[model samples]
Target chain A: MKAMQGYCGFLGLLVSALLVGFLAVLFTLVWVVHYREGLGWDGGSQEFNWHPVLTVTGFVFIQGLAIIVYRLPWTWKCSKLLMKFIHAGLNTIALILAIISLVAVFDFHNTKNIPNMYSLHSWIGLIAVIFYTSQLLLGFLTFLLPCTPPALRAFIMPIHVYSGLLIFGTVIAAVLTGVTEKLIFTLKNPAYSTLPPEGIFVNTLGILILVFGAVVFWIVTRPQWKRPTEPNAKLLQPNGSTPEGTDYSITGDFGNVDKSDEDGEAAARKRNLKLDEVGQRSTM
Target chain B: MKAMQGYCGFLGLLVSALLVGFLAVLFTLVWVVHYREGLGWDGGSQEFNWHPVLTVTGFVFIQGLAIIVYRLPWTWKCSKLLMKFIHAGLNTIALILAIISLVAVFDFHNTKNIPNMYSLHSWIGLIAVIFYTSQLLLGFLTFLLPCTPPALRAFIMPIHVYSGLLIFGTVIAAVLTGVTEKLIFTLKNPAYSTLPPEGIFVNTLGILILVFGAVVFWIVTRPQWKRPTEPNAKLLQPNGSTPEGTDYSITGDFGNVDKSDEDGEAAARKRNLKLDEVGQRSTM
Candidate 1:
């Protein structure tokens, strides 16, 4: 197994994304329970249509798969020629379906008779931000899709990785803001029978912790491409050629090795070996 | 003198993103004005602070540039490559600084000796939906960042384009829902000071038109690419040497006969010939 290198930062973001998802589920349950007995505020809806909410949110959970796929390195080693393409195809389909379904519900719900201040709209708003954060993560994974040029993948990954963290951090800050939102609007007090304590310490702690974690993750998991001139000995190529170039910190390696259309079986085999190395450890 | 084609859709999206941004500015102004006195239903904060809200939002806007940079296509023929990189780089640096500033102010406001419910948190929470949305548009735009492999670009463009409309639609819906958030907690007052009657119709109509336009455009613009064979000319390798035969529609042909990586006589001569072929037109 190859050595597992850097990014102590992903720990924070992974934890935070999971934390937010857990909280969403918790709040979702709370709202559902209260809505059924006509005790909670889902606007004037007789019962919480948890079906739609859950469906959209289930898709959200699927969306987070991008984290697993992307945040970690491409450490899988498979022997099949088309396996990566097949796997990527499946993932692309999954993302497309999930996004389509979730967004459709979002569209319908937004235009429904529900009130905005303290109704399902607010809940959905919070959920949508989380979902969008996860979707960005999902799309970031596209850079790693099968058959893509290594140079192109290398080019997009860092931008995708760091900006993704930024999006996640922004979403968390926004979500915490939402939690406090339910408090500030207490003046109106439309949803809650009584106001929940807007625990300044608790909320601030959430935001800071979330922010700190996100920032560290941003700095840590930031994908550092093997410098361009460095022979890109480990870089990926579309034609499946994996040439072993020396680590050149100089000219000719602009990180864009567009040699996919070229035929080089020897290079392809070398790349295959590298894949096996990464895949072995990742499964471990 | 280039033919007007696939870009119309892009232009439509450009208009939509701007509309959404304009709406955000308008809504921010409205909310500030509406709540300037502080909603009296809850115990109002004795002191006032607007600096934090402004700063967070400003930083968010600064970070928003990444979206613009990532969106528009940047083939070899595109203008001002250096300027594009500069805009992306400088704004990112600025955004980082602003985020730091925002966090400091957020810390201060959250800890202020005032009612937490009526403080800066609520303002952010209420507007978080808009800001998060703006980010989503930006994030989606990044997904469309200039990449080679016309095939991949075509595949990503549709997803990027359609999903963008869907997310934007959802965010707008959430806004409408927020405008009516107060209706959830109470069954009594059908309307409040913030809930202006005109807003309901205007927003709903705007959303409908936007959605209708997006759906129709998708149905009409989608090319039949799933066919098993090249129903047209066989796919040509970029170098015109190896042919990975596939039939694909060319919705985005930028006439790259002489386009290259460097400023040179060959590229200039081609441009001049094209210019002479068709004299300058008023439209870009």
Candidate 2:
């Protein structure tokens, strides 16, 4: 299962980057045409107004998500397996969501925001900024805190994982609208533009991004968030004696003494006063 | 100090929102004026192209920030103080920076792509986006992991935090140009438009948004991502303890055990066995 080193988690990011580049060209061309053709000059097409807002905003947010999911910090005990796989998966999801959201944002330009044209995707893009932002906020805390406290651990940890699923799921919002718009556009007039994806292909990207992002967000944010940092050994005694006034060091490694050394019981008994006290107290 | 919440954030938000609104209206108005005046209908205004792009894009991003920052789901542990304060601060900044960057993106209506009036604000606005995106990335990671591992904690974490500060500081990128342009326009033409802040102030908002976005990303992402789940606990356990194999549940109530229920002997045996099995084996 782990054989796919890089492939496992990069699904979201690859798609988003490609979408951003493609959309930049598509949007730019469309706008340039409007400007040249004087489509909205007389306010005849109010829908065009929504395009610039959607496309540029979507692009910026995509950039925002890219950084968060791709480059989270590391943990002490994590092997290369969980760490790399999680990061890759997260990056893939975020990137995909970003692309779908971007496409959804531009739904206005393609007339998808209208009453009849409005689909689930229109609402998704409208609300996508939240998912993207939520993902970023959660990522930051995990990377910066000292340790995930139990109280907090109970609440926050589960959320990022679950939210990841939702975020990726929401990517469908973009795909639906994207495909619908493109398909309809091509059908409306077979005189499709010079654009490679034409109308239908570009429209379909929203759902692809949604699925990609949700999967990625789940894969990365889910496992790493729930993982622990290091051995949290509770020293049963002060200086290994009693919890009386001894400050509990969450770092469980106690002074190089191998915990498994039980064979030297007789000799070690003299030095094991703390353990004995804890043992005796337990027996009472 | 917390008393400053007396609609302090509100004032900034309202003002920023209004400014954004005015700019949008002004952008479209300017285009209409040019069309009616018949100046840009044919040629003379190469720089005008960027104006609509900038004005529209700026609104999109600032509005995007507004929508996401408010609606996104936060980890259960996010501090109310930090979240509210940062939320208001960054959104305000986004609005201001949008206006500021507008100066560069919309330097002049009848000018060329390489406008003759290129100034410090324009440069700052361009660079500000870099910082804003970086902040978003770092923030996401911090929150996703809350308390990142020791490996790159010092480096990556600091970069994330600093990116936010840079974003805040870069507000001059957007506003300064507007200030100077208006000042010049007013001095020579008395009909000086309501220029945005100049120099540092212009880009200050962008810088702020970048910073705010970064920090917020951290705040929201951490706890949720880092929360401990039962599955994660199982994965971390070396012996691969299933539900039936180990009595140690991964519930957050680690210290809430009922003092061994007054049973000492049996507890000791189990604990001793647990101690013996350190990392290689499980008491189960």
Candidate 3:
């Protein structure tokens, strides 16, 4: 019964994440097409509309999904190596869309003779993209490449998870700021303060994005939901036992050193040893 | 040598957090007073200036300090109960400031004949404040009140930490959006997009807030930095050993259950047993 409840809870949250994510994208589309000019690339205001659309769809929603991909129970049956590719592929798609969105805004700005990268939104959004790109490259090298040392992968894993989530959060901040900037600039006729339909719609979209993010964070942080080490993994010795003194308990916020990639076996073993040392020491 | 390095790293991040937090508040003041109107309560825009200043100081800065208070190595020697009070006190102060800031904005809007709670900034900001208030009160009841059961406290502990960080992140989103809104509205003479000095100043302030937040998250999430289970805590039996099958290996993302509060002894024991059961299971 308890297991059933846990399963139900996970399903409910997953559904909520998807529903809110879809609504957020739909709301952005309506806000742009129905309220503002439709999306375009003619060096016009419409070209800039693609920024919010792609940002919500790719940067916020898709990146959020990438963060929690490992937590999905059904995916547990798949080999960790396969899951890593899916994770990386999703993130790559999000990055591509983000780059295109950046081009849209910059292109529109240049054509319209407006200064670029001046607003808090642009500053933050650009930095988040740069950080995301760096994180992606480093993560791929550390977790996916065969030549990287297991010790190094173990060392970088926590930093990788922390930075990934941090970048996701920074993206949310940028999106919120970008939405505010857009509304302020575009809501001249009815004025944003009048509580116009577009204002309420876009505001709802912003809240949905936040809710989606909260759901993703909650899913990924639940220790019970963390991906388990595969039975065939080499973390277990030939005798089918974990190494002596291995501390399985020191799961960080993202949990268990992500035993779902190519280096996961050696990485998990090395990380467990490191965490054991850290856990034993009371000071540092 | 390693311990010294860890300590220095902690200190460096701590100093960075403080520096950025102070600068964020200062920039808000300068942006409001030097660029726009100074603080006031005459039911005017000047009264509204208090909104940004107080939100950054109380909501973002002090509240951030409260979130990472337990991670400070110096504080590990202090009683957990005392730290709880400090945490609650700081959050209470932030709540009070947030209330006053909310009133200022509402009053200014009424006086100016502008509708309230219309923009994405207001929507997200108001929800964040509400969530913060609820989280503060619930945290107090669950973690502070002596009548609460240890089992219950353990169950709620993770949720509390997760929500606290989530609310902190939400406040940041609100602050970023608020800054964008203010710059767009106030930088009309020079135009925000034209890269006015005020615009650049406030944009930098927004980035500072993000950096401060990133630093705080890093400090608290580090497994090496989490407060240790106290020596005399009841989780360690009278014989100075954990109970059989206790599974001390299952430390969660925040580290060992907090061992400083009044309920630390019983709560830690109960929490460990629960985690042991969950950890042994291959699936939730």
Candidate 4:
């Protein structure tokens, strides 16, 4: 188990770094290589460029990073509430970017007199975005809110986790479909069949996106990779002890109460193992 | 939890049925609608039609079914070895079909003097096949072979599970890319942008494929959906006691000995719970 942990620790960081780098390259490929005319909300075909650029940045990259936040070892010492806020914040940014990207696509289509939502990619992409928005809102209400009862939190937690991962997968699928659509639609000189540099880069980007999704999902879902609660974890501040301007938590909801429960369980299990070891030693 | 199980069971069945129906529809779309010229190994464009037809049949549908075989409720009553054989058999068939599909693609490209592995779809699809083949061989060595030590099996099992899911997702992404490529490539008169009936049907098929992939992943990964082990499960036949022509097991490796250890743990826990209940009743 120790060896496995060591392996995952190194591997997870390498993959995460690669994922981020790939996102940057993907952004550059679309924005810098293809749309050198520069981005604007009202420009001609240049406006359409934001659809891929922001979607990759906010939806694919940010959303993926958000999913793996819990598995990040560096963040293990951070407050769970703070981590939750960070997760929600990143997703919120992704959502805002996605919405704007959708606007860009719609605006471009309207300007060009092209049909809207004509492709399978559009249909699934729209669904993914809607699902993501709802997921975020529900997650915020259930997890971040203090008024949420423990029973409700427990009941909804599993579904939230499952839905989050599913939506991430859905988003990646949407991006692949979108990229394919764009490449096939735009490339005509050498044809996509000839495998031009742009086509190759786009294809590599798609593959990297898929790779990033797989790595993120693997890291998030592996049971042994989940962050362990610290035994001496500190309690959150009491009621009316909100962190300065932040109004999210009014009470010590993220306190040591939950941690102590888990810590007690762990301590009991450890004591039982020690007793077993002593018994074995005596017999020997 | 019982309600959750009920929900998952019904949902799994519904999704599985829909997946099969979608695959049939996808086949009908390509073979019946687009390629009414009929399928032949030596025909020109007709041979190209087999690329999509066989891929959807073997790579997508059969592979998916193989992934979820353990989750099927009806299969719980079957012998573990028999289920393993069924799982391996379906995958073997899927692998054969995938190889044949690859041959068809290469053959068509060769006959037309078209370049091979040019598109992003082909690259990802080929990689998926390679990964799937390797995963199958490794799984066979670790699980089916009696020579594999228990420690090795324990170490490899989690990785096998993770890789299986990753490959399934990769294949789905490849399929989406392929469908997008074909729709863009084949439709000329109306063009894919016009969304003709064939284009519409093809897009819907792609969407259905995505839905099927999502459903299969959900069913396969959910802990509650896993088939429960029977408490009184029978042991595999001992050496020279193999059933009929089967010779894989030289010992009762699939026997109930391991299960008894788990059952004993459960019984001890139950006894502790009962003692606490009795003490509480007396105090009350």
Against the true structure, whose DockQ is highest? Answer: 3
* Two-way TM-score contest, 1 vs 4, winner: 4
Q: Return the clash pairs for model 4, or none.
A: B235-B255
TM-score for candidate 3, please give it.
Answer: 0.85
**Individual DockQ of the candidates?**
0.04, 0.02, 0.30, 0.17
List the global CA lDDT of all models: 0.35, 0.35, 0.75, 0.66
DockQ of candidate 2 against the true complex: 0.02
Ordering by TM-score: 3, 4, 1, 2
lDDT of 4 at B233: 26
Count the clashes in each prediction.
19, 91, 4, 1
DockQ score for model 4: 0.17
Model 2 per-residue lDDT at A9: 38
Over 4 Å off in model 1, which ranges?
A1-3, A6-62, A66-181, A184-198, A201-284, B1-4, B26-284
- For model 1, what fraction of the real interface contacts is kept? 0.01
Off by over 4 Å in 2: A1-119, A127-150, A182-187, A191-197, A200-284, B1-284
Docking band of candidate 4: incorrect
lDDT of 3 at A162: 77
Chain B TM (all candidates): 0.37, 0.36, 0.84, 0.76
Q: Write the per-residue lDDT of candidate 2 for residues A74-130, one digit (tens) a residue.
A: 222345235534554455454454555344335533454333223323443445556
How far in Å is the alpha carbon of B262 misplaced in model 2?
A: 27
lDDT, residue B97, candidate 1: 48
Tens digits of per-residue lDDT for model 3, B182-228: 77777888888789778778888888999999999888776555555
By DockQ rank, best first, the candidates go 3, 4, 1, 2
Q: lDDT tens string, model 4, B78-167? A: 777788888888899989999998998899899998888877788889899999999899878877887876546645665676677778
